[model samples]
Structure formats: C-alpha cells, structure tokens
Target: MAELTLLQAINKALEQQMEKDKSVVVFGEDAGFEGGVFRVTAGLQKKFGEDRVFDTPIAEAAIVGNAIGMAINGLKPVAEIQFSGFMFPGYNQIVTHAARMRNRSRGKYGVPMVVRMPYGGGLRALEHHSESLETLFAHIPGLKLVIPSTPYDAKGLMIAAIQDPDPVIFMEPKRIYRAFKQEVPDQEYKVEIGKARVVKKGEGMTVVAWGAMMRETQKALKRLEKENIDVELIDLRTIAPLDYDTVLESVKKTGRLLVVSEQVKSLGIASELITRANEEAFLYLEAPPMRVTGHDITVPLPKGEHHHMVDEKRIAHTIKKLANYEV
Candidate 1:
C-alpha cells in the first residue's frame, strides 16, 4: 500500500491500466509530454512512450471522435478533456456516437472508452474552468458518470472505468486533486461502478455528497460533532447509476435527508436524490429533505468564486437545519 493524493492516484490508475492492457492508449490536449494540465499524466508518456500515451491538438472534437473510432476497432482509448466545461466541443461526438454505439449496433459492439475530465468548482479558477456539469452526462443513457472524492476511490473507480465495456465520463474534481492523500493498495483493484460509500453511520440525518464537496461536508460533520447531531454521510461516487439503495436505506433510518453539491441546485443530482427519497421513502421522512448547493448562474470568476462554493459553514448550517426541523 502507498499513500497517494487524488492526482497521483489517477495517474497511477492510468499507468497500471496501460501496462496491463496493450490496447489502452491515452491522449488529450497536452495530455502526453506535458502530462496534462495538472500533471495527472506526468510520467505516463515517458513510461509508455508516445505511441500509447501521447498528446493531441487543441481540437476536442477530434480527440473524442478518434477515441470512438479506436474503441470500435479493439483499442481501449482513454481520452482526456482539459476541463469538463470545455468538453462541449466534443459533446456531440460523445452523445451521438460514443454513448450510443453499443445500442446503435444492437449490442454487436461496445465503446470501451473513458473520457477523463477535471470538473467542478472550488479553487478560484477562471469562469470557463469551473463548472459542475454531472447532470449533463448522467442525463444521457448508456453513458456512465463517475466522480471520486478520495484518492482510494479515485484509483479504484478509474481502473473500473477503464475496464468497462461501454463509454464512461470520468469526472475528477480538480479542487481536491492535491488537497489530501490516502493510503491505497499498490496492486490493481476496482470499486464497482454504481455504488455509494458510507463514510459514517448516524441516526440523526442522512447527508449525501461527492467529489470536492465531500471534504467540506466532512469538516461540517466534525463541527457538528459537539452539537450532538448524529449524521450519516454518504459519498455518491457514481452519479448516473446512483446507488439509490444505499441513500434510500440511510434516509429511511435517519428520517431526514440533506444533499450537498457545488453545482447549481436546479435540475441537479440533489433534486434527483430528493425526488427518489420522496417516491421510495416519503413516509420515512420526519422533515422535508434539504439541499445546500451552488447558485444557478454561469459559474463565477476567480474573484467571486467563493460565493458559489459549498463550504463548511454552509454545510454545517444546513445540517443543523435538517437536524432541528420538525413537522
């Protein structure tokens, strides 16, 4: 086992996958020699050589389009998009071809490709560089969406995404890329897709989060510890095929729900989770579920970025509200 940061975990996952599978090739905007914008692919090109791990032009469409073609012909292509917000140029390819290939071909072929993009807002990045668009890809069927909040889950989930037969949008929360570290196995492992991890068990209320928000939520949990608010925390690692069973069970036990995300509240993952809780566990609730999320507007620039983030103060306050709610 080794202690690694989220950034290092992702890079390790790619290295292990490429060495294990000859057909696995990685490329994106400055993904090769430059090792990506955050150095997530730093040593990959040197270790695997330019053929298997290389860079691409500034063309997002070309990168994804070529990945689809390669996957169809027996190559496992791991494509990178510098930022999730910038994936729009390649969105058409993903939605039209990569996502629908298996179904379009009637199960005759599968797009075993992973599109890696750093997503979400926390650090004071440029406006275009900050966006939590999980709903965009999760809304589409036949495409898997993964967001890991910890280094252990990052490696496990990335490896699972690489090995998956269908297309996957692996969104890395850039905010926590180097924010922390965790001890993870050096050998290969997979945290099955569509599963949620319970960070802690509690009886007061259920709180769900993923990616960078997990860290902030955890801090809030600690602050509320003295408040005697027994809260259960869930890390929703996969967004699309959400592990609703885990969420529902927790909500059932806690009888209260609070979902936190940095993305805008409208039409977001929190809405979906609350809706499901209403549908499947309405009677179990003691109070209406709550959400602490980003404002609905274009992500603010670095100057005003803090206003849009869900921090410990916001999360702790929301949890207290849910804890004290009645009726």
Candidate 2:
C-alpha cells in the first residue's frame, strides 16, 4: 500500500489498467505530452508510449467521438475532457452515440469507454472551469456517472470504469485532487459502480454527499459532534445507478435525511435522492428531506463565488436546524 493523493491515485489506476489490458488507451486534450490540465495523467505517456497514450485536438466532440469508435472496435479508450463545463460541446456525441451504442445495436456492440473530467467548485477557477454538471449526464440513459471522494476509491473506481462493458462518465472533483491523501493498495482493485459508501454510521440522521461536498460535509459532521449531534454520513460514489438500498436503509434507521451537493438545488442529485426517499421510505421520515446545495444560477466569478458554494458552516447550520425540527 502507498499513501497517495487523489490525483496520484488516478494516474496510478490508469497506469495499472493499461499495463494489465493492452486494449486500454488514454487520450484527451494535452493528456499525453502535458499529462492533462491537472497532471492526473502525469507520466502515463512515458510508461505506455505514444500508441497507448496520446493527445488530441482541443475539440471535446472529436475527442469523445473518436473514443466511441475506438471502443466499438475493441479498444478501451479513456477520454478526458479538461473540465466538466467544457463537456457541453461534446454532449451531442456523448448522449447520442456513446451512451446509446450498446442499446442502439441491440447488444451487438457496446461502448466500453470512460469519459473522465474534473468537476465542481471551491477551486476559484474561471466561469467554465468550475461547473458541477453531473446531474445533466446522470439524466441520460445508458450512461454511468461516478464521483469519488477519496484517494482509495478514486483508484479503485477508475479501474472499474475502464473494465465496465458500457460507457461511464467519471467525474473527478478537482477541488479535492490534492486536498487529502489515503493509503491505496499498490495492486489493482475495483470499487463497484452503482454503490454508495457509508463513511460514518449514526442513528440521529443521514447526511449524503459526494465529490468535494463530501469533504465539506465531513468537516461539518466533526463540528456537530461537539454538540452531540450524531449523524450517518454516506458518500455516494456513483450517481446514475444510485445505491438506493444503502440510502434507504440508513434513512430507515435515522428517520431523517439531508443531501448536499455543489450543484444547483433544483432538479439536481439532491432532488432525485429526496424523491427516492419519499417513494421508498416516506413513512420513516421524521422531517421532510433537506438539501444544502448551490444556487440555481451560473457559478459566480471568483469575487462572488463564496455566495454560491456550500461550505462547512452552511452544512452544519442546516443539519442543526433539521435535527431540531419537530415534524
């Protein structure tokens, strides 16, 4: 085992996967020579050579479109979009082709590819550099959405995504790329997609979050402990095939739920989870499910970003308020 940052773990996963499967190839804007915008692909080109690891033009559509073709022809192409907000240009290819390859062909062919992009806020980046658009992709059918909150899961899930038989959108929260470190196994491992991780267990309430928000929520939970507020914490590793079983089980025990996301409040992951809870565990609720999310507007510039991003203070206040509710 080795202690690695989230970024390092991502690179390690790619390296290991490529080593194990010669069909695995990685490419994107500056992914080869430059090692990607955040260096998550650092040294991959050197290890895998130009054929297995290369770069593409600055076109998101072309990048994904080509990867889809590669996947159909038996190559596992891991494509990276510089940022989540920049992925819109390739939305047509992603939703129309890559996501539909398997079903459209009636199981004759599958797009066994992984589209990796850095997402979410707290990085003080430019307008298009900090978007949390996981919800948009999660809404599309035949596409798996995954987000990891720690180095261990980051490595394991990346390997799993590459091995999956269908298209997957692996959204790496850039904010936590180097925020923390964890001991990750040197050998390859798989963190099954469509499963949520229970980071902490408690009987009072259940707090669900993923990506960067998971770190913030953890800080809030630590502070709430001083007030004797014990809450269950769940890190939703994957969003599309949501792990409703884990969430429902925890909510049944806690009788309350609070979902947190950096994306806008309306029609986001939080809303989807709340709807699931209402459908599956409404009678067990002690209070209406709550969400601590960003505003329903474009992410603000650095000068005003604080007003739009969720933080430890906001999450702690919301949890305390919900914990005191008498409903």
Residue-wise lDDT of candidate 2 within 119-208, one digit each (tens)? Answer: 888888888888888988999999999999999999999999999999999999999999989999999899999999999989999999
Which parts of model 1 have CA positions greater than 4 angstroms off?
none
> What are the runs in model 2 whose C-alpha is more than 4 Å off?
none
Model 2 residue 309 lDDT score: 95
Sequence-dependent TM-score of model 1: 0.99
lDDT against the true structure, per candidate, is 0.94, 0.93
Count of clashes in candidate 1: 0
- Itemize residue pairs with steric clashes in candidate 2: none
Per-residue lDDT of candidate 1, residues 19-93 (tens digit): 999999999999999999899999999999999989898999999999999999999999999999899989999
